[model samples]
Target: MSTTNTDVLVVGAGPTGLLLAGDLATAGIDVTLVERRPHGLGNMTRAFGVHARTLEQLDARGLADELLATGTTLTTARLFGRLDLDLTRLPTRFNHLLVTPQYEVERLLERRAVDAGVTFRYGTELRGLRQDAEGVTAELTDPEGTPLTLRARYLVGTDGHRSSVRTALGLPFPGHSVIRSIVLADVRLAEEPADVFSVNGSGDTFAFLAPFGDGWYRVMGWTRTRQVADSEPVDLDEIREIARKALGTDYGMHDPRWISRFHSDERQAPAYRVGRAFLAGDAAHVHSPAGGQGMNTGLQDAANLSWKLTAALRGTAPDPEALLDSYQSERHPVGAMVLRSSGAIVRLAMAHTPLTRATRSLAAHLVNAIPPASARAMGMLSGIDIAYAPAPGTGRPSGRRAPDARLREGRLYELLRQGEFVLIAPGGPAPALPSTAPVTAKHLIRATWTDPAKRTAVLVRPDGYVHWTSN
Candidate 1:
C-alpha cells in the first residue's frame, strides 16, 4: 500500500475530469487525476458538437484555436421539411457549431492538463472514499491492482454515469430507462451529404444526420416500435437501413469504423455535493443527448466548480463551504431544465401521431417566421439561454447569460485564458479590487457603454457566468 496527498483528487479523465484538472492546475492547486483506462484515447465518439458558450470557456483557456483546427465548423442547423437556422447570426465569434469527435476533444484537454502539471494515473480506479470534517480519504487501486490510500482536501467525481465515487457516497440517481434505442456509427461515406445537419420528421421514425469529417456522418433516430431493447446489439446493415428509410434515399454505408446503440436517459444526482466530496459532469447530471448538450453541459459544470474550489482552497473566499453550496443551488435547476427540454424535444420529434406532427411542423414554421422568436428558441438548443441567478447584495440583470465582447485593449476572453476570475468594467478603470487578492482580476476599456453614467462592471466566473457585478 502507498499513501499520497493533494489539494484535489479528481476521478475519471474524461472531458469533464480533464477540463477540471486543467482549471485546478492552472489555478496553482495541487490536483491528481485518476482514470480506469490505460494511457490511450477512447475511440468511441460519445459527443461531437461544442456550443458557443463552451467555445468561450475554452477560448479563455487559450485552446480555442487548437480545438477549432481539429473539428469542422457548422454554420447552419436545419430541420427537415423546415427552414434552416443560421447559427452565424448568434452573438459570439464561435457563432458556428464545432463538430469534432469526443476522442479528439479528450486528447486536446488531456494534453493541456498534462502541460499544466496535472498528475494523471491512467489504468487506476477509485475504489472507495471516506470524508471527515477536515478532508477526504480515498482508496484507489493501481493498474497492477495494487491498493493505495490517498487523501485530499476535496474529492470530485467526473466519472461517467456509473460513477464509483457517487455510488460509494450513496447518492441516488433516479431516472427512467431509455425507451428508444438508436444506432450511432462513425464511418467514411462513399458519398457525402449536402446539408451539414438534417432532421427527418416526416415518417413514424425520426432521424437526425450530421456530417463530421473525412466523409463521415453521424446518424441518429428512433424506430417506430419500442421493441428494441436498449442493450440489444446493433449492426451496420440495420443502421444503413434506418438511414435510407429516414432520408428517403439509399446511401452506401460500406466502410464502417464503429457501430453502437444507445438509449437516452434523464437522471441527475440528488445533490451535487456531499461533505468534502463533490460531483460534476455526468456524475452529477445525465440527460437525453438531444440538441448535443450533454458534453457541453458537463464541460461547463467543470468550469463553474473549478474556480469556486480554487478560491476556497486559496482562502480568497469567506468559506469553502459557502461557495460549495452555490454549486448545487445554481446547477441543479439548470440540470432539471435541460432534462425537461431534452425530454420534450425527444417526444415531439419522435411523435407517431399525424396531428402531433402537423402541430409541431406548424409551430416550427411559426417560430422560424419571426426572427427574434426563432433566435430565442434556437438559443435554448445551443445552450446560450442559460443564465445564473444573481448573488446576494449584487444588483444585476437576471436571466441574461454573460456575453463575450471585445475590450478596448484586448479581447474579453483573452483575459480569462489565465484561468482566473475576471472583472470587466466597460467604461474606464475597474473598481479598486484587493491588491493581494488570491483570484485574478483585470480591468477592461469598453468600446460602447450600456450605461454611460453607471460604469457597468461585470465579474465573470471561470464558467463565464456573471457571478458578481456593480452598476
Candidate 2:
C-alpha cells in the first residue's frame, strides 16, 4: 500500500477528466487520473453530436480540425419533424455540429492528456474520498484489491452518473428518470438520409437517425407498445417496428452491429463542490439526450474549471475562494438550464398523448415564426450564448464568450494553444494587472487587432470567456 501526491487528482478518464487533466498538465501543474476500466477506447458509444462551442474549445486546444476530419457535420438540425435549427450562421470558426461518437472524442483527448504528461492509472477504482482544510485524500483499490492512497490539493470527480467519488462525498443526486426503454442500434441502412441528420420521429413513438461516418447509422427509437427493461434482449424487428411507427420508415436497416437498451434520467448533484473535491460532467448534472448536450456540456465544464484550478494552484489569483467558487456560480446555472431545455426536447419528442403533442406543435410553430427566438434557441442549445453573470457595471462584454479574432500576426485560437490568458488590445498595450508585458507575463498572451484602427481591448480568459474589457 503506497501513497502518492499530486497537485490535482482527477477521477475517471472520461472526456471531462481527460480535458481537465490535460489543461492542468499543459499549465505545468501535476495531475494524476485514475480509472476503473482498462486503458482502451471501447466500442460502445451513443453520444455523437459535438456542438460548435465544444469545437471552439477543442480549436483552442488545436484538436478541433483533427476531430472534424473524423466525423460528419450537419449544417442544419430539424426539430419535431418541421422546424429547422440552422447552425451555419453561428458566429464562430467552427459553426456546425460534428456528429462523431463519444469514443472518438475520448481518443483525441486521451492522446492530448498523455502528450501533456498526465499520469494515468487504469484499473484503479476510487472507493472513498475525504477532504480537509488543506487538501483531499482519495482511497483506491486495484483490480487485485490492493489498496492505494492518493493526496492532492484538489480532486475532481468526472466519474459520471454512478460516480463512486460523488457517493464518497455524501452528495445527493436528486432527480427522476425521464425516459425508459430507449433502444440504440448501429446498423447498415439500405437507404441513407439525404441530409446527414434528417430522420426524426414524433407521436406515440420517437426515433432519430444519423450516420456514424463509417457506413453505419446510429438509430434511436422508443415506443409505448413495447416498453422493456435495459437488460432485456431486443431484436431488429422490434426496433424496425418502432422506427416505422415513429420515422415512417426504418430506411431498410439490417445487419445490426450493436444494439442496447437504455433509460434517460434527469439528475443533478446538490452541490458541485464540497471542500477540495469537485464534480464535473455527468457527476454534476445529467439530462435527456434530446439536444445532444451531455458530452458537450461536460467538455465545457472541464474548460471552465481547468484554468481556475490552475490559478489557485499557482497562487496567481488574489481571491482563491472567489475564483474557485465562480466555477459553481457560472456552471451550475448553465447545468440547470440544459436540464430544462433537454428535458423539454425529450418530452416533446416522446409525447404519446394528444394534449402534449398539440403543445409541442404550438411550441414549434412559435419558434418557427419568430426568427430571433429560433436563433436564441439554437444559440442556447449550441452553448454559444451561454454566459456568466457579469459584475455590476461591467456591461455586456464581461461575461460573454470572446469570439475568435484575427490578430496582426495570427488567430486568437491559434495563440490560445499555449493555454494562457489572451489580451486583445486594438493597437494598445496590456494593462497593469501583474505585468503589461507579454514576454514577462508567464501565462498571459498579448496581441493587437488585425485592424489597427479599432480601439477596444478585451481580456479573454484561458477558457475563451471575456474576463474584462478596457472600455
Candidate 3:
C-alpha cells in the first residue's frame, strides 16, 4: 500500500469538506480531500437554502457574489401558514435566503480549492482510521480497490449521517427518526407558489415548497396516514395528494424531473473531537429540514473549523490543543440549538392532537405578533445571531460575530479574503499590531475604521467572529 501524508485529511467532498479544504488551501495549508464517489457532481441537490450568515461567510472567501447570481432570493419565509420570518429585515448585507442548488456551492468551492492546490482523491473511500498524539492515519481504498494509507496532522469528517470517520472514532450519533417515508419531488409547477417559500401542514399531511430558479421547484411532502419503508416506490400522485391536503393546492405540479422517498432524523454526535480526528456537518449533527438549514449549517461549520485548524497547523496558536478543542465547545451548542429549533418546527407541523394543534396555533400567533420574539427567531433561523461565550478568565468579549465593519480602503469581508485575522483600529491609519497579540505576523491584517467608532480596537478572527476587543 502506498502511503501519502499531508497537513490535513478531509473526508468527504461535499460542500462542507470542499469549503473547509478550500479555506485551508487558501491559507497555504496542505489539504488532501477523499471522496467515495466519482469526480463529477451528480445532477442532484440535498440543500436548497443558503442563509444570510452562509452568504456572509462566502463573501469573506470572495465567492458569495457569484453564488448569489446563480439563485433566487426569498425575503420572507412563511411557515405553518401563519408564522412568517422576515428575512429581509435581518441585519446583514445578504438579507434573504438564496434558493440555489447545493451542487452550485460545491462547484465554486471545489474550483477554489483546486486553484489553491488542494489534493483531491475522488473515487476513494475511507475504510477506517487511527489517530494518536501526533496525527491521524486513514485506511482507504482507491478507485481500483487498491488499499492506501494517508497520514495527516489532523482529520475532519464532513461525510453525511452514516459517517465512516465518526464510526471509526467510536462516537455515537444519538437520536431517532423524526419523520418517516417522506417524499421529495422535483417538478415544474404550472402555477407558481404564492409565497417564494411556502410551508404548511394539516392534521394529516405536511408540505414544503421552494424554488430552485428556472421555474423548477423542490417539493417535500409527508403523509401521516401512509408510512412505509424508504425502499417503497414513491407514487407521484400520492405526493401530490398529500401536498394538496396540507397546502390546499399542488400548484398544478406535473412532469416530475425526479422523485424519491426517505426519512429524516434529528441526531447529534456527543462529541465533535476525538483525539486528532474531528466530526463536522452531518457527521456531527442532523435535523429535520423544516428550516432549510442543513447545508447552511454545514457551510458555517466548515467556516468555523477551517481557521482553527489552520492556526493549529501553522504553529501560530498559543495552545494548539485548546484552540482545537474550541471547535467542539463553540459549535456543539450551536448544533444542539439547531436540533431543538428544527425539531420544534417539524413536530409542530406534524401536530395532530387537539392539544398539540392548539399549541401550534398559539405558538405561531405569539411569534407572529411579537416583534422581539420574531426577531430572535429570525436571528437564529438565519444564522445571524450565533454568539460564543467569553473564554474563561477573559472579559474581552471574544465570541460575538463582528458586523461587516467598514474600513478606509474596503469592507471587512474583503480584507478577510487574505485568510488572516483582521485588526480594526479606530479611525486614521491602523497602528502596527503588537508582538504581544496572539497572531503570527503573516496571519494578521491591519486596517483603520472608516469612522471614529469605539475607543477599543477590535480583532476579528479569520472566520469573522470577534477574537478580542482591546483598549
Enumerate clash totals for all models, in the order shown.
Answer: 1, 0, 0
lDDT of each: 0.79, 0.87, 0.89
Per-residue alpha-carbon lDDT of model 2 for 1-471, expressed as tens digits? 899999999999989999999999999999999999987748486788899999999999999999999888888888778778788878887778898888889999999999999999999999998888999998999878899999999999999999998899999999999998999898898987765565366566888888878888888888867777899988899899988887788889999988999999999987888889899999999999888999999999999999999988988776678788888989999999999999998888877688998898898898889989888998998999999887344456688988888898588888889999888886655565422212227777889888878787777888888877766
Clash pairs, model 2 backbone: none
CA shift of 81, model 1, Å: 3.1
Which candidate number has the best TM-score? 3
Question: Where does candidate 1 stray beyond 4 Å?
Answer: 398-400, 426-454
Q: Write candidate 1's Cα lDDT for 1-471 as tens digits.
A: 899999999998999999999999987999999999888855585698888888878888888888988878899887655757889888778888888888878888989999999998999999899989889999999999999999999999999999999999999999986446877777666767776576775546767777775467777766775347768988877777777777765367667777778777889998999999889889988887777888988898898889889888877775557777888888888888888877766776776678877777887788788899778766877778778776655555632566776565467677677776667665655576433223543322223334455466666666667656564
Candidate 2: where is the Cα deviation over 4 Å? 41-43, 391-396, 434-440
Relative to the true structure, candidate 3 reaches a TM of 0.97
Candidate number with the higher lDDT (2 or 3): 3
